[model samples]
Target: MGPARVAGRRVGQFPDGSESASIYMNSGTCYDLMKNPTKAIEVYNEGISKYPTVSLLYFNKAITLFNSGNVEEAMTTTESAIRYNPYHASSHNILALSTANSNKVYSLLAGLYFLAAEPLGKRASGRLKVVEELIGSNVKKDGEKKVNISMPAGDKIANKPNDFSSVELMMSMSAALSYSDSYKDETNIEQMKRNLGSIFGVLSETTAAKGGKKAGDKKAGFGWEFYAPFFADLQKKDFLDTYCHIIYASSEDDANTQWIKDNSCLKKLTTLLK
Candidate 1:
């Protein structure tokens, strides 16, 4: 899909409308459009140097790397992006695509995140379709235990010396709350939901433990951090309604089968259940 594969995956724009940030992202995007992977990587690296905490910069850089055939490096950079922000749906989506053949469980977990975080995203439908195809595949290696999120997304990523993003440390505590053991016997979307619910449980526990303060001092309410992507730009009740619906949704429930499409990429992923 060329470098353009990475173009539509961007989610959040530069913060505060900083001209420098826009220049960084715009230059990267421009380079990508021009099919100059070298220049795109340079621009994104520059952005990372200037704004070390900006996860989107890392995400864009990883995409360029992937398009340039630097698959290993791209995986590393994508993991960096996720370290900076667990809510980055695009980062998770990229990871899912990059490592699908290696780890079916991890790939599906990433897909679950991408769908949950960017249910209404423009490019998510296509990506979701790809992930759904993982259903019924016997890709698990022998001795594979629970979801092995311990390693980076790949060998190359594991080799890199990564500094834990503050976000990573904060979210790690919550990630520990994931239901790693509950879905060992499930497959496809059922397994996906178990992971999804596990992540929610983690976020719920972490947010409560933190007394409701997010990384930027934003006050969260109850399980808001777990549902941060949805709550980021919503009324409390609307966010709550969305969260409750997803947590309770079922494939057989007609209202949910229809409603999920409007609210998430679940509609796009429904084909997996077939």
Candidate 2:
């Protein structure tokens, strides 16, 4: 029988009930580190069979799948991980990266969620870039016009009721508007605040109209359930400026850095969440 199939073989190895799941996660990681992605997947699957609700197992599996270039499957598995443990920051990180190309809305939400949970470190720096890219993905500077707008095409971004299509379009428009003469003179911090404010404003409106049902309500998915609601609430409460600064805490901009020091908004944000 497979090592994972040996039920209760190493029970109580740790004081807590996490030992069995940890073993499987570690075993899978070893395989992944050895460049045996197929075997790593098998091990992760076996672990998942026994611990279907263990987010770590699902997270490890998703990592292997993502590294092996199975992005769709990786995204699916990462969603499972988030479903089981919404607070798993790394799962949100991978989900953002996996879906960034296929679905900008999901990518932006996941990336934001990850940054909220882990707003420091190398992982956060990279995630911040992804979030910025998602925000700026649909705008351009064409000749003397100085601002050109574009929207992602295809059935994936079609305008379905209760879907992120509107939010996506609004985000693109926000990006284009940021370059308009009215906004062109603002600092990057102000520009970002405006852009994200527009995006989150639409998100709040859509999520509220949907009665805040679970994710997958319409074309929305885990992002709607886990990340959107919180951000929507933040927008509603007018705390989006605090949030933007928190995620961009590493910015070297004098205004950004000064804002972080001048305000207790970061502490207030954490308190509000709790």
Candidate 3:
């Protein structure tokens, strides 16, 4: 029989609480694996109704929504998961991927949060690639002699302050600068450090300008309240280098591995995130 049937058969044997929540989550996952997203969402929602605070239920539902191509709903459900448990790494992972095209900075913020919690895993490896793409997405090379820089125009369209336009422009500029003569000799890791550091610095400054406010206007939400502060603090604490290495650790890059071995900041970062 299917996992849902198995779970149904054993339902009354276990008490209602976290363990029961896990059964729901597992049954929902079984449905998902069986290519039944509708049934999966039904099971997850039932679990959420019973254990309102279980973040995994929301996370599993978000995954189903995303894989089924209901991206907007997936984003909304992931936000709910984050609301219940801010440190849910898989929730952050889905959020990062969902927002990568629509919101660059928010994707990076969530990507970093996910990596911080789940470094040195298959998930981290995939997220690191996506984060690197976001950091470099704006810069395109036409030839050895020509480069194109693309910047998002959302802030211009909205005509608003405290938006991500500055960071987007900064990212474009930094990526363009990577092709400059002065930076041409730098290794891929070095370029990543500089470009990623530039992005983080701008976000940190934005956070400071907001004067510790939990949210900006329409553009800011969970990213402002949670991710912005976390990464901003990392930038401020001079842990950006350490962080870059940590997120890239799954790549097994010699430099990143060596840096992690030489530095004491990983423990400190873990503590801060906790």
TM-score of each: 0.48, 0.84, 0.84
Provide the lDDT at 87 for model 1.
Answer: 72
227: Cα error in model 3, Å = 0.9
Q: What is the lDDT of candidate 2?
A: 0.77
Off by over 4 Å in 1: 1-19, 120-128, 139-253, 257-274
Question: Comparing candidate 1 with candidate 3, which one achieves the higher lDDT?
Answer: 3
Clashing pairs in 1: none
Q: lDDT tens digits, residues 179-249, model 2?
A: 67887798666777898888878766665224454333534565666567777787888887888887887
- CA-only RMSD, every prediction: 11.3, 4.3, 3.6
Candidate lDDT (C-alpha), each: 0.53, 0.77, 0.77
RMSD, candidate 1, Å: 11.3
Clashes of each: 0, 0, 0
Worst 10 residues of 2 by lDDT: 3-12
lDDT of 3 by residue, 1-274 (tens): 8777787556445655446788888888888998989988988987898899988899999999999999878987998899899877889989988877677877887887898888887888888888778878888999887989877666432333234666677877898988789999987667877987787777766532233433332345666666766766777877777777777779978876888888865786677687
lDDT score for candidate 3 against the true structure = 0.77
Candidate 3, residue 57: the lDDT equals 90
